[model samples]
Target chain A: MFDRETITNDRDPLRAQFQGMKGKLCASPELKAALITGTPLHTPAVGKRVHIRRFSKAIAVYAMCALLLLGTAIALPSLLKGMDPTSASSSTGDHDCIPPAVAMSSPSQLYERLLSEPNVVYREVGTIYFQDGSVKTSHVTEMTRRGDLFTTLNYGDGEPEHVRYYDVGGDKPCVYYNRNDLWFTSELRGDNATWAHWCKAYMAVNWLEDEHYEKTADGYKFTEEFIAEQIEEFKCEDAEGTLTFQDGVYTLRVVRHKEQFREEPCESVFEIQISFGNAPEIVLPEATICTHEYEVEVIPSDHPCRYGDETRYTCKICNDWYNEWSPTVPHNIVDGICTGCKLSEEEIGNLPDDDPDNEDHSDIIYGPYVEMSISRPSMQEFLEFYTVFQRKNTAPIVVTDLGDQKNSITQYHFYGGIINKNTFPDDYDYDYSSGEIRVPIQFWYSFYYNCDDAYFGTYDYGIVAENYTLDNDAVIDLDNIRLERVSTGMETFSAKHELSAKGKKEGEIRYYEIYSGENRLMKFAICAVASTEDSYYDSICQQVVDGLVKLG
Target chain B: MKDPQDDRAQIVENYADMVWRIALSRTRREEAAEEVVQEVFLSLFQKERTFNEEEHLKAWLIRTTLICCKHYLTASFRNATISLDEVGDLPAMSEGQSTVYEALLSLPAKYRIPLQLYYIEEMDSDACAKAMGLRPGTFRVRLNRGRNLLRELLKGEGIDV
Candidate 1:
């Protein structure tokens, strides 16, 4: 039994110490300085680990609705061009590859069909040896009843191995059966490595058919035969370039002029080859090994990349490396804690001159990081200013450091690419179509350094959501925006907008307009350095556009 | 009836002492406890459009304050990135010893939150149960356990209740 009165009689004596913390918090020298100076204080959102928490229900609903509509709009042209799943383009003499009359079904139904009926009879047998001195065998088979959709399997003799189904326009290895046409799919599985690794290889091989893209800017025009030749010619040894072996890693630098790099005109162009082990499997794609003009500095992490660990953290940029996406050396901090990394061009130029032991360094870059670069349009500009942050530009998002102690680091992440929904043909397979307006969002933040204390990254606060309606239709005419100093009587803030474009190669800027409590204007000016477009991806961008439309 | 956003901001400005006191009672550490108050007010500001009236927003703030305080206790164990080594440098008062305060700091997260909500927050046991997201019977059990632990800790330090 407990003494009820005694138990209930607890109180906090330190209550008096915090009599006015809220008011004081607003007036604190640190927050006040940040509010006025506009210089970020601590690990600014810019280079921090991109921790996108689940959106609130209202926001999620608003965004999803917009995206769904956008997807439908962008997809209509391509969908119309799709002549019954099995039919080929009437204009081209090429064989009608798309299957028709494919009965569309839910993913669950497809899974059940593969499981119960053995209807998806994939039967290509292969053996794989595991690193742990073990061997396993696999067989793959396919079945397409209505022609377009194909249910497929890659399994052991009788057991259900990794199974999948593909709608006609699905991405590679996912299978693309012509709707009403006869299509065949092959499957292979072996314990050569893990299931995931083997699956990656199989998918890569089967989806190896050359894809022909009409010449756009820096694009490739490939056919099945050309792709097969490229695949056959591919040898870790005969990569046709200079091989620099460093730290157990081998790198081949392949050069290509801006124009010759692809079908479309290329502005930023460079190519290279890199390999690690004796296995040709270690070879990376041409895009992976290429180096660009900027430098990237990956924040060092004390935690080595390992399984089950959430390796989500941020890195700092030294400000001076602003506006350049460069290669990075992943590292850890002094506290034995792992965060993000900064990327820089300088780091790539000074790679530890070729060493055989650099095998670990050659591992492929994954996960998300920021890419920072500065661009002054260098020409006269025009209307509603907007900032467009891109997730990827051939090379993914990279971060650079501004040596300025105030805003030490920032990042530009490869947000993913945007398609001109207007330009995308209706017949193209599963594509994200959209009008010219786009917003590929990215994060930017900085830390307020304390010499007496150790702080791993910069810290500043800002909004994180799919999209925000501009006060005015200010995005189209990007020239109206410019960076300037902002005064709020007691504080100051610096403003800037960032922009990125692919087709027309135009720029946009973003700025903040401050209004007083009395509805009187306090500050109004164009700003720069931080923005993204809504046109980055089909599935996701469509929603942002919808959000904008809903707001409208 | 002023704008709800402005009204809620006023409640935060006016009742901040009440919120911070409850937070300090639970967290014991001042900076983190202060952060809890800031989060509560910031949340009120961000969600200003949702509340029906001023009082409703106040209640939400108070509830959020308790949750934030409880979160601080659990968060402290896993995210002890900020070192507590310097906490000893602060000077002690010449009046009564702050043994109970120290004792509360030593208690586990589950016990600390229940005791603070009931005693320092001035909420009834049922309200405490609601705020902590627990059943009334469970809330009573937690209170007993917390009170016993505090007594024992203070007893060890030669402090009479």
Candidate 2:
């Protein structure tokens, strides 16, 4: 048999080969950047723009010769005409004096038309979310292009806020970030110059009418959703734009989402603001994500029976808000029926509670220590529960010596009298008045009838353990919490109990502990379910122990 | 709330490679493996949940990686073409190691996974079985059978384990 040492020894091939797996598979920083920032990495070389030819080569070649003959005749006349009045002929750079009002894609003949366009500044106001639609480490990116100089400031939380300079013109924009590594260049290449995403977005959008519209008194209002497929300069799996014309003004909003690691589209979209050329000396904002200094209000559900509360968190700064669903309030149970939910614990266990008189009494069957039942519980006598549980109950009634696991030829009753090491006498003649029960902290109870299956069934319980008087119904911490109904909400306290009690035993042992701040006593009424076949009895015993009101 | 970047770094450090390996094994494509790892981590970081044990976290990554692998294979929009070179990582040739590695890859995953997990990953047989969704005894039998086949394959290659 091959062992760990045999397989993993330094001399071995398996271990040696795998030792370099990390090196070969070492994750790229771009991958980490993509994962962290949610950027797409699929930068296919901006594919050549396909042009559909209108005419075939044969016809075009024949027509070209005729046009050239006519053009040469006109040129001779024009040259002669110009020579007679020749002073000096000159031309200027083809750049237009004005920059485009909208920026996404610039004209392809940039060399001809770019020089005249004035320096442009792009500032993204408000919040900038990452690919995961999270504002964590959010920063603003400001780009300004003047002549051949394009400066970008990407400053904020997740990464070090730094100002980078790029010499832009012609090719890709290359940036050198760190002072130490002077030669290292950034992916901030000429292909992905600061304005490229905007340019790509502008060029790629094929605006389609949105199916959804808001009905208005005049007629209807609709927005156009622009869709962009794979474009090389952009890394996103897709980019979408919403263009809406309202009144006399037009607005465009673009959103991009992708994880470079997967090179796939994701649901988390980042909404960025793009405005062209109004070069204001750009400055950073006070908050990358909203400060959310505004107060939040949580309104409880009107249907408390089923739905929990709906809460709204609003930001005073941005008026940006989100909502959340809180869990339903604990079911309101009265006499085994909830006034709030109108369902009893038995009904929740699944059946309607038609019998008004048949109120559940878990304390009766599972001993007085347990205050309530979470799952439906049925128990009659201790011996009956012990038999099926495979545990011999070593209650004081059975074992003379305390803390003993197996009590021979004997049986036990469930008795929890913590604070006193000694167990109550076999015939203590106890009533359901004053009982003190705290588990495993000071006392241990091992009651067994038989074996294996029983040990597996014990589940731990935690509680506040404050002095609380038990009533016919359950409530806790007594006078501190004056609610009439049982509360399942447990506070964190380092107390736990797993009743590793075993087998079929059904018997009543009652003494309801009373501590209403000052040790007062009250007896709880008993409710017993009938026991039948051994399996039937064991199943009920399991529920009794199982139900022990799962505290947390 | 916890700092998101710190949380991301911690989760990536803890499970990135484990996820990468599982994804690589299931998808059998380098590109698909990277995609699966990214998707799994994205889903993990996006959702809000807590695990009491690192074991539970690992189990979740395994399950999620398998699901991601399935999605990658079955996605209607996927256009990626498979390349033989991208299928798996190659080990350095030393002694009969490369031969052994090739044989291991040739075996069916059901048998291969048990051996790899137990021997290569140093996971116990019980954990290997649980991960493979098989009973402990079944996993042990497969391991033994897989070992025997590997030896036979190696012998045929003029080498002995």
Candidate 3:
């Protein structure tokens, strides 16, 4: 391998050799022949511009003539008459005064004369589609002409995208995009355009006339009189000129007007400001006649828009065509139906009554909570908060017990009560007339948790632990609880459930106490919704936990 | 008002060698190279666009020679680069030229082009980089790899490193 060091070392020497080689090649006779005859030729110097084979005889004859001319001075004047004007001319002053006239070939006159008679192909036009799904047909009324690269696109019921390749010569070909209001270069070279113009003009002028125009009802339907009349009413303003020189060819064309006609509205032409060499003039050629028929078929036939389930009010006319649950209105469709609802509870063994003074209520801090609170501190307050919490957090909040994954906390929902605007339980704190309750802060470190998919829904819940209430007015702190963002767009505090439980479940209560053990762990995950509106409640709940919950 | 003599002299001095080399490189036919070299220079003389320097002169010669080669080999030229690679591997005499120069003759265009610009043309990394449209750093890497591959044949023939 030629590594960097070797390559760098060789660079100077190699360049020196290259220079040497160039000199040798330049001096080599083979190279000289290659330069001149493009092949090695064994011959003496021949006259410059003399073809290799034309040498021997031609030079011999020329030398003999020169010798003869030197011998005869009297005949020399007549022999050299056309040869050297320099020696015979009396004065050099006459040469400086008059310049020879240059002959100009007028292709434009040839074009005009060629176009004076109707081009046979003009009777037969070809149709092409425009951007807006309307079609226009163009006819070659004259020889395609050397300069015009005009093509038409139908714009709606009129002209929309108008393009003309003008000044189509030179290295950079110029094209005019009228509708876009810009003129720029086309990628093709000018010579290519000239050759193409030659071919098209030849075809347009020479192709046998197909009276196909008369055969079609719409063909050539707008006669010269109608086009002239339309041109009279049209506006010609904001015209621009374009010029180009390329590939031994030069062209200049000016655009005078772009207008729609009053009577035959779709018939429009670029009123061209024409210039061949010196003079500039105007010509109105009917190029594009925009049609309305093609626009209606632009959209696919089976599209929902065609079936009348459109966003616009116009689609409502076809409302009877579909059901209220139609996917056309995305909001009405949902993943699964809410089939059943209920409340149940299982308790840890009852707590013995203790003195309020030594109870240490300092451990619980309830909220930055929102929603209705009936803080009457009745026996019912503890029952309702416990019930609602369980209904909301069905997914057990996992907590780390030991360092191992196996030793994790899981909640078993034995029983809890749920009450809402529609269903309110008796013996609940405030009747349906008074709404949901609030609890304050708590946070902790915990292991990750996953809810059983069968039990998780758009709304699901979990319970931490409960407290006995002195009355409905007693405030509870929620400082030790752990919950994760299950799904967003949850109507957070909207539902209130009040439960009255006369429960004794031996093992169930023990499990609740085990979950509430001093080492109960907590973790959090952010739940995001697709739409911005849906993320609000989830953001608030996450913030509330952060502000109020703390772990030691 | 230009004299034909001056134009012919200018074309010969400027483009004759470049046109010959491009045609020879492209067609691999000496006769074709001869034909193309003459035609290309003649055409340059006839064409109106004026060339002022070596770079413009070279570009015109290369472009014209390429067009002629494309016309001559229009059939097999479609995959001519592959043929070029096959030819680039031939042996060379100890005179600092390798058959790889011939093999370079065989080298497919993809390989042959970079090789020529690097070695034969004496174009440094940056110039080769511009010609190949590759970044200089990339051209350096490609040149190293291509040289190493060409070096394989030399190693087998007992050529000293």
Candidate with top TM-score is 2
Local accuracy of candidate 1 as per-residue lDDT tens digits, B72-122: 543343233222222232224323334555556556556777766665555
How many pairs of residues in model 2 come into backbone collision?
46
- Candidate 2, which segments miss by more than 4 Å at Cα? A1-29, A40-552, B76-84, B88-98
Docking class of 2: incorrect
Deviation from native of the Cα of residue A238 in model 2, angstroms = 55
Top-down DockQ ranking: 2, 3, 1
Error of 2 at B69 (Å): 1.8
> Between the candidate structures 2 and 3, which one is better when assessed by DockQ?
2
Q: Give the TM-score of candidate 2.
A: 0.28
True contacts kept of 3: 0.03
What does candidate 1's lDDT look like per residue over A131-162, in tens digits? Answer: 22232322222232223333333333445433
Compute DockQ for each candidate against the true complex: 0.02, 0.07, 0.04
Model 2 lDDT on a 0 to 1 scale: 0.34
For each candidate, the alpha-carbon lDDT, in order, equals 0.31, 0.34, 0.29
Residue A525 lDDT (model 3)? 20
TM-score of each predicted structure versus truth: 0.26, 0.28, 0.25
